[model samples]
Target: MNQETKQIFSLRKFKTGTHSALLAKYGIVLATTAALMGAGAVSADEVTTPQTQPTTEVVAPATDQTSANVGTPAQEQSAVTSDIPTSVPADTTQDQAVTAVDNAQTTLKDNVSTAKDTGVVVKEGDTQEVVINNGNAAEKTSEVLTDLNQQDKAVKEATEKQAANQKAYEETSAEHERVVKEGQEHLEQSTAEVYQLIDQAKKTGLLVTETTTDQTPEYKDTKGLTGDELRTDMAENLELYQAAIKAGIALQDKSVADLKAALALYQANQKAYTQGNTALKDAKSSGVAELEGADGRQGQVIDLAKKNDVTIDVKHETVTPNYTDVKGLTGDALLKAINDNIALYTQAVVDSVAKQDGSTKDAQAKLDAYLKLLADYQAGKGTQSGIKWAENTTVEAGTAQRMTGNEPAVSWGNLRTAAADAIQSLDRNQNTDATFDHIFKINGSGTVIIKNTTNGDVTLKISNIQAWTAENTYLAVWGAKDGGIAWGVFATTHGTVTGGAGEGATGGNVGATGAILAMVKSYDYEVSTSNAVSTVTFNDIDNNQTVTLNGLDGAKLVKGRNVTQSGNSYSAGAGDVSQASGGVIDSNGIQFNLADAKTVTFSGSHFLPGYINTSIVAGIFGVASEVPKEPKKPNLEVQNVDVTVPEAPEAPKPISVAVQKATVTAPDAPEAPAPVEVSVHYYKMTTTPEEPTPTPTTPVQKAAVLPETGEAGSILSVIGGVLLSGLGIVGVRKRKED
Candidate 1:
């Protein structure tokens, strides 16, 4: 082990009951408290957020060692980040002073040593003999103890004043930090609002101005363009959108710059406060070390005296501070009592140091002068007062106010119908009490607004239409009315149309009264032509549905006709139906077809014919009908014609073959067949191929057959004799068969 490690281990092995061990424990306590106080006084200057969103700052809690559930060292350190004072509290300072005095007194009583050999206790054999003499060294040691006890009081009072000053600095600095943070949060929120506004403008087509040239060259390469490129192209094409985006970006930059400037000031102040607190902490810690070191040296001085031949008489009693009680006294009476307490504590210092070594004589003289000043102040003779000096100065922290701004306009739209429909879609069984609080967007536009009010009869105003169009677009909003129809279409006129039908909540009719099936607001229709076909799309404030129309012949104008307005006066000329003459209905041009009909087709000469129920209305017409029936037939022509049939070819004929007869012939007489000869030969191989060795067996040989020898001869003889007779019979039989 290293020398340092061995020393530390040896120190740890000391008994807890020893005087040095107690001093070590108290020393550690003092050091720990000092470190914590220093750290806490400075950490408040370093608060910061880890995210873009504003964070609520939490003030650190101070540690109280007296609590039963006091946390572990790590936790205690964490909690002691702010509000902890670097200087000791008055109560703690007082306690330390009293404890130190008690320790000094006890040590003096225990150490039996003196500079003179008088008053020595000699032990001879089993008996102890005491030699008594008046010793000047013992008397001097007692006076020294008394003086150190008095010095403790002055240190305690000084500590209290330092603590109060530190508290004021901490509180004021914390307030300044809070104000700075609020400024930062305000800027962040302001920037966020600007961004939200820009986003809304981009989404609702506000960023897009009406461009006349559809096939602009810059957009021709859009097929392979990235997201940013596409946005840039659109912005460049639309002057208003481009301007809006620039404004938003500029606002964000300005807000951030302002925030940064404010933050810089805040950081500067925080740094100054932290540095000041750190300096104060260092001073307090040094003072504590000095006081404890002086206390430790007192014990060493007594130990040295004991080693010498001098014998000292120990004092058994400890000196405690005494003060005159002034309870029930008011004003100056109480003040006088406090002054006297200070004076008495001071005088003790003078008395204790007077008999000490000549080196401490200077300190004794200074204490005596201070005691005389306090006595004169009690007698009202001097202007210098100790009470005034001991008191703390009051400090007030500055105010911090949070910044405020108008809520951002995300988007606004006519949401009367959309709100109603969303409300209707909610589960009636589960949330019957739920009210409509939804916002719907204008079709193809960034503008969105919601009908937040619950009152049924209220009319909602649509704002900011001038940004999109100079022309006035009127809407006839329909809403649900009482009993006349389960579904009603209502219209309330805003512009020039007077005595308009559907003015109030009523049933469907041509004038003044219309069924309230749905209400459309802030509606607009856009048309574009390409390849001889014009596409028409309608956008409304109602978000519940949309309408799109395609395949309209460009040469002919396709019109919108409110099916409810059926009178001859409302009828449009061949191609006169336009945005100016309003006949628009629910999204997708969907209308409830309650009329009983066998077939229906929404077709016109100017448009490509398609099923009106399925194509134009998205088949909502089928469900909107009062009664279910066969689907509508598309507008087209059909006919029937006969088909020709051909006869099958005849099967192929089978092939034929002629039969031939076989005949037997008999040769003339008695030629016997010659006997076949057979012969056998044998040879032996020397080696086998597989084993490379051959075992030979006996070879048998037979002569070539000689007609089986005599047997064949005898058979041939018999056959020749029989052949002679058979030949004659066979010739006769063959002749008869032929």
Candidate 2:
């Protein structure tokens, strides 16, 4: 029989519109093409067989098909029968039918095996193949590549984090070392400065006062410590300080109690000292100590003079009580008698003290001896050591007070009127012009004089009383030599005077003036002579009052000047000399003569401006001089230590990091079912199946082109030739029969 068959496969199913489905379709196309070629070859062989030849019509002995279970029901029902003509051999028909049956059975077995492995069902006795869908591997590959890219980026970020953290740690460590070194240097310098300050204080006599005890209580135990031991202890303390600085603590922030410990060390070292070598040298050069010694000797002289009934003058001059009593003594007897006299003996002590060398030790010893001898003499014991004979008479001890109270105040007007009257009274027709209210000229000399008419004390205030031109003259103002009112200038200059040129009882026209008052005494009107080698003489015309100096030099005079008057009032003056109270002439108003008077003497009670005991005026005239130079400030450098920076903080630990990877998900694929074979049904059964009619052509799809199957030149051409030759043979036989 001729048959046409269509087979349907039971294979794995998949959803459409997905990557997996697309892959399944492509696999099915390949499998179906191969199966179609095999079927075409078999159909060509069937068509070429000879139709006129006889074939066997074989009928098998009937068996119960219902009881058979070798295959499907359709297989059991199906049978093949062939009719053979008389001209053909019966064996040939039987053999041809049997061979056909064997071929069908073999094909069914092959299809069943293929269906099981591919998860597809094949139709029995048919050459059509079943397709199984596989998973979509292409989609998974794309996802895996994307995840790897993300992992690469994360690794790069982690590496950068580690590098940054490492750099920071290194920088912090370097800064820490630098800060430590700075702190070490600061500590060393600070220690050295502290020690230097202590050592200087100890060497000098600038003793630490008791006030430092409260500031430095912790240093109480430093009393017996040597300088080396103290320095060693101080160095040891720096170690503790260094540790604190390293740990980020400020040195200044330490407790007050702790700071006191350092201060205490300095105080203890300087307790008995006063001043450094610089000040001591200055004091020695200036003869300050010597002057003080002379003062003590003068005091001794006074005590001895008073005890031995000597007639000492008000000026502390004239050491002998009665010079007339020793006039008859001569030669060695005169010298022995003068040496035995208490007044000359004390005078010798005073002279010796005045001539002391400018040395601290010598002056101190002289002062001590004089003080002790005076103490003995005052206690009715004669001079301790044998008196050394001397000629000069200069003994200074106590200070005199200025007259005070509501006494009539003297002004420039009062002094001017008095000066005019004195000149007019002394010489008629003498030109006495008042240049200023307080300055005047007399006898063609720039000199004037005034008298005190008040019964009580009166203050004589003078302003601009200076030697302005070359004609150096004298000015004199006097009171009762017995009045004992002292005269002084609040400020004075030996060389030049300027500005203070007006006068009033309360106010005047003058600029602010600095106090030139001496520490001991300063004279108001001082005039130097023009002669290159002459002497200025302070001629005490009235010897009723004597004027004595602390020493031969004016530099040793104690400043007894009061502050200048301002607004109808005078300053509360300073110094024992300036505030001296009594009936003493305090003003320096006396006649000055630029002539050769070798010795400048003071035997009057009047304080005279013409006589300053200093060599500036007392030296040979026309010789320039100045007061001794003041001691210089100590040459000490306070080395300050620099503040240190705190140590750098420790570096933080590095960050732990890593890149995160992405997850990849491929499209889900359908699982393949096991394969099986089923019964086959034919579309048409006739002597020969007719060829199918051709359909309209369809447009091909654009898709991935599969590789070449290799059937183009050989397999397809052989199959087509077989089919054509079979058709030609069949047609030739038909025409002959016609």
At residue 417, give the lDDT of candidate 1. Answer: 33
Per-candidate TM equals 0.12, 0.17
Backbone clashes (count) for model 2: 44
Cand. 2 TM to true fold: 0.17
The count of residue-pair clashes in candidate 1 stands at 24
Candidate 1, 405-505: lDDT as tens digits: 12121111132432222222212221122222223222222221111111111112222221112122121122111100011111222222111111121
Best candidate, lDDT-wise?
2
lDDT of each: 0.26, 0.27
> Model 1 residue 707 lDDT?
38
Q: Residues 672-737, candidate 2, lDDT per residue (tens digit)?
A: 212222333111111222245465366333222322333332343454455446434543543344
- Per TM-score, the best of the predicted structures is 2
